[model samples]
Target: MSDAAELGAFLKARRAALDPADLGLPPGISHRRVKGLRREELAQLAGISVDYYTRLEQGRAKNVSDAILDALARALRLDPGEESYLHNLAAPKRREKPAPRRVRPELQQLLDAIQAPAFVFGRYLDVLAWNALGGAVAFAFAELEERNIAKLSFLGDRGKELYPEWDAVSREVVANLRTEGGKHPGDPEFARLVDELSRGSAEFRALWAEHAVREKAQGWKVLRNPVVGELRLRYETLRLPDDPDQGLVVYHAEPGSESERALGLLASWIAADERPVNTRSPHPHAG
Candidate 1:
């Protein structure tokens, strides 16, 4: 979608996500046609004219001021991430960045040194690199059609089994993608991926339409690994200052717990293989 269209769609989605009663709004009409706040109600709340808000919703308003954006944001109760996404949509055309072609030797070493499963993700959520444990614990990476986290979560055959908490995990993936989509509105890769996923799964289409924006920095995941049974692991994202486009995600279990012992056994099973896993890519970019 064009920036104007995306801006309008985002506004509509957010407006629909709100509750009228939450803001002390009465049921003004017995046969109210719209969900959430009506156009007049939102305009009144934002201190804007109803006609102007209508224009904004229709993508007819141009050169949208920060003041207006701020007012709408407040009225909609947008969080920091959503507000930023709104701003980005209004002022689209942020430049596309080139992805790194190869992980640094030091970076690859860092992943290998980690005791637990670890992997690096590119800007578009492609699996750029993964340690041996990551390979064993998470997926058979090389054999997969696409190394993208979004595709893996939604489109892959094993996605549901891999993530026992499928709904939450899948939403997280979509939210993270939405956050990226907001920042780099001009990115073709982002558009292509969204189109593919939306076409493939009705769930993906529904979640993508939510316009939820989030940066998943840290979280707990219950992964059902085939080798070691269920792994209740806590994952942390380490953003590289030198390369902001790439990040290392490490997943570890609590010390001395059954999950931890299972991880140890998993690691041992990984080490037992005479052939070392291919943890680094000659060409780092996935697409």
Candidate 2:
């Protein structure tokens, strides 16, 4: 399918997956004809005409003002990440600005200095670079033949083992991708990745249908550390000051905690088994 057509399908599908109750709409009967908020319902929430919203979803709307876009975003109850995605879709020209070549060197150096595990990632969640500790915490990076997170989550058995909550992780991954895909509808690489995963995994198909989006800013992670059994670590996502698309994702554990010891052991194991690689080497950057 054409890129624009594919994007339209993706946006529509995601919109359909959201329930009216999610947006605080009164509970409609289960026998309602549609699964999610109806087109008119969404229009009412956005304080726009149904015709206008329909045109946008149909990929026929033009000159979508920022105010209108913001209204739509608010009506959709989009998170900051998802709201950005919506704006990108309305104005495809913005994404033409290339992401910066290197994340600030200071940022990279800082990530390296952190004794704990950390990695800096671009907007697409491309793995620009990571410290030795970072590699140790998420062992899947070393094992990844491709660095793209979506591909790994859906296509590889290793991801299943690495992500303790595989189902939840997969859903978030798909949702995030849905937001990205909406923003860069014409991005060939993004389309190709989605097609490859959709064709390869049924689990992907189901989650893709749910149409959720998330910013991978900060969260708790439970990983099956190959070296340290299982460790539950808290990760904070720090957005680089200059690079909006790139951020340092650092993992840490509470002090005097077993997870902390496991992290140290995992670091030692990485030091022993894997050579420290460049932060910019060709690796799939998946968020």
Question: For residues 54-152, could you state the per-residue lDDT of candidate 2 as single tens digits?
Answer: 877777777678998788777766678877766666674544665554555677678778898888766455566777778666754555546666776
Whole-model lDDT for model 2 versus the true structure? 0.70
Flag regions of model 1 displaced more than 4 Å.
Answer: 27-31, 92-95, 282-287
Off by over 4 Å in 2: 1-30, 92-107, 140-145, 180-185, 268-287
Model 1 TM-score (2 dp):
0.92
Give the alpha-carbon lDDT of every model.
0.84, 0.70
Q: What is the TM-score of each candidate against the true structure?
A: 0.92, 0.81
Ten residues in a row with the worst lDDT in model 1? 278-287
Candidate 1: tens digits of C-alpha lDDT, residues 100-180: 645788888888898889988877888888888887888667455568888888875678989899899889999988887
